[model samples]
Target: MFKRIFNNQQPISLKWKWGILLFVTLTLFGFFSSLIYQQNALNIQLNQIQANHQYFFEAAINYLESMDEPIQRTHFQSVLDEANNNDLNNTHDSTLEFLTYFESNDIVYRFFNEKQQLVYETQHINLNPVEYSDSLKRMDVNNQMALVGSTKIISENTGESVGSFQYIVMPQLFDDIKSQMQNNLYVILIGIILFALAISFLLIRLFLRPLTYLVNSLDLVEAESLSQLRVRKPRSTDEWSDLSDHINRLLDKIDNYVKHQKQFVEDVSHELRTPVAIVEGHLTMLNRWGKEDPEILEESISASLQEITRMKGLVQEMLDLMRADHVDIDYKDEITEVYSTIRQVFNNFVMLYPEFQFYLDIESDPDELYVKVFRNHFEQIFIILLDNAVKYSTDRKEIHVALSTSVTAIRVAVQDFGEGMSVEDKDRVFGRFYRVDKARSRDKGGNGLGLSIAQQLVKSYRGEIWADSVLHHGSIFYVEFPILSDTRQIYKSKQIAKHKSL
Candidate 1:
């Protein structure tokens, strides 16, 4: 995600963010739907189990109704006695026997005849599977609790047809009720999931609306033609609107700045040239026609010479800076042995600034080494800094030159033990036409563009230059460029060391 943010060029749009939101919301919806669906299936199974239990309950009631009911108190007393006496047996056998009583109408009567010479049985019910159970029997619905029902049947003891009755009872149905409850739970959860999806869709659209408008406005813009751009007023004051307004203001400032720069260049040049031309014109006339008049000739010639020379020096410095500014430079990078380049620059400086004592420090590399850059540009950069050191040193007496190359880059530093500049002045030293001590600059003819031009030239070859100095101690100018690969760090440092030593 951080890489995505770092590398993306286009500004984010509302539509794209909206689409991501939609996709994530739908994914959550689908995830929850599957969860709900699984729960639903479980609920259905639960309901089926409850339904099976309800059928078993109804069957139990049907079997009970096949028994005879006790009516008279004496007869009821017999049943009470039987229930009391057989309570232990009833605990185990009655529930199972009750199901079998459904098969024969005479079974209960036969039991009574064999035991006590008593009453009748009403009817038989087959314990077959019914609608809710795995059986085919019809369930008795109207008299579910009616433990006995009348039936036409013959009692063999009476030898006549008669109305008879029977009953057996039990009352609970848990399984099917539990299943219905589970189905209800499933229905509720599905509703909640659908509701969440609806809310999510609304949230996504609300979050993305403003960004969409901003994108639509941006898409309508054309490059190289900001005149056609119309920054539509945003409905809300947000960061996006602030960004747009800021950009428009910046564009306006840039437009005006470029116009002013061109005008300043032309106006300053033409204005300075006019006075120079007028002074030279009068000097030429005096020298040509009044040569016999020695005083006029000498005075005219000297004044003319000074102005022309001043103009010439000023124009030359300006040209050098301009050339530095607009160069189409390519560093013809090769294995440039730094020891050789540094020695070459150092020798040239020592010869030119003869009065200054330059202390050389070129650390030896056991293997031959070179930096990957144009040697000429590197040498020129060093020469400019060395010249500055010589020019500003206290009466041109003390200077230091140091050179070293590492695995990654090469550094050349020239230090001057001179009256150093103040902190405020050091910051502006590399700016064109900036001077630290103007009085000293005039005496030395120090063109203020030298360091600026040198910096520009160094930067063209992918190198850097900077000055480090204090108010009293000294100033050190350092320049560095990348090192060459496959060049051994162990030098033939002495091979070139001997040349510079001489």
Candidate 2:
């Protein structure tokens, strides 16, 4: 119920809330502590006054005892009556004279008899009779705070209580000290509250300044102004710096993706335009003269058919590229034997290009070597690589397919002794619709999406693919897949053996 009330309260900024919470907590703690200290100090002062009053009272009583005169009730009463009536003319009593000396020093003495009746009091002060208790008491006398000390007076010879003596004195100096302390406490409290607020504001601003800058920078970013979105680097290597670094990295990825998307659209349009224009031109020629001329008709029909086939292949490759983006979700848990898949692709390619010399190398056991990839997708990857190798092989007409295993992964390399590629071509060979030899690629019915599709598929399977090429010494495309555990290899071998036996 309390939590609901708190949640429904008016919203506050985090900075102000935290600052105010800290200030309030400290202020409360300090206020209570100051109150306790002040109370303790006052108590100590009161105790000191009590102790001093008791000592002085004891000294006066001892002086009276040393006078060697017996204290008579009747005579003491007569002296009190004389003092109360302001008649000091005939007073020759030694105890009364001694008691009067204290009156001169600001101490008021009140005497009570065994019957609890006040017998005598100082003539200078008029004090009301108070209840006699075992302990000393504080009283308001003559409009001043005073401490009253009481003690029973007994005869030394008989050890019998006769009367009681009371002494009262106002603690003016201690009162002044307490008043000053209270004023100081109020001043300190006000200073502390003001300090807390100022420091909190400064600290919040100092800490949140970087965040404000970062937000402002983000606000400045737009579709056409992504390059302007640059957050200022923080001065320290703290969480703010880490946040800035992460944001910069995210921006970099977004920028690259946007640029790649734009380039992809442009490349696709450029690639399809040639084939489309060729087909349109051929159709126009056939409609004009090729209907009557059989040679022209045959030529135009063949040209149109070739362009159509190229367009169909380009469309299919584009679809494959799109599918590769989401292939991981489609085949997340699929697994395949790396050796068998490579062997199947190798055999097919060799038969498909009988004139080309194909060399195959397997450095791991074919039955034990496995990777995390769908079987068909795995075969498709190698087919693309092998196809490229065969198509690029020049007069040497030689290609090599090597499969090797490491402690962590399975490595496959497809090498072709072809016209090869320059460093620039090798770098961009896997880019969408990018061809090293554009005219040659067009003549050979290649739309240049093969390697790009292969790379994306390899990425989906958590694999790496890159090419190493020499200008005249051909190129080798390397693909690496993380190897499945030994347990998977054993299980697959058992399953394969069982299937074969059946």
Clashes of each: 19, 0
Best by lDDT: 2
Candidate 2 has an lDDT of: 0.79
Compute each candidate's TM-score over C-alphas. 0.45, 0.73
Error of 2 at 50 (Å): 5.8
Q: Give lDDT tens digits, candidate 1, residues 1-502.
A: 5566568865665554665577567657665765677667756854574455445444544443443432223443444455567653454344235534443332222122222223433333332221222222223433332121223333344544333322322111323444555676567656656665575667767655555665665576544454445455566788767866876676565655465456537644754575478676866677578778888877777877776776677677677666654443433323366787787888888898777787999786545556655455566677778878877777548888887777788788889988788888788898765678867874676656678768877776567888899886779988887765553432443334455559
What lDDT tens digits, residue by residue, belong to model 2 across residues 1-502? Answer: 4565479775666666677777787778778887888788878977886787677777776664453323446757766777888866568776767766665445667667777777666644666666654455777776777777766676665567767777777556556777988898899788777877777778778887888788888877764478557677888999999999999988887887788789889988998898899999989987887789988888988988988998899999999988998888976656787776788889998899999989999875755566778787889888988888877778899999898888899899999989789978888899999888888877787789999999999988889999898987899999999988868554775576567569
At residue 30, give the lDDT of candidate 2: 73
Error of 2 at 192 (Å): 3.3
Q: Please list the C-alpha lDDT of all candidates, in the order they appear.
A: 0.59, 0.79
> What lDDT score is found at residue 255 in candidate 1?
55
Q: Candidate 2: how large is its RMSD?
A: 6.7
Name the TM-score of candidate 2: 0.73
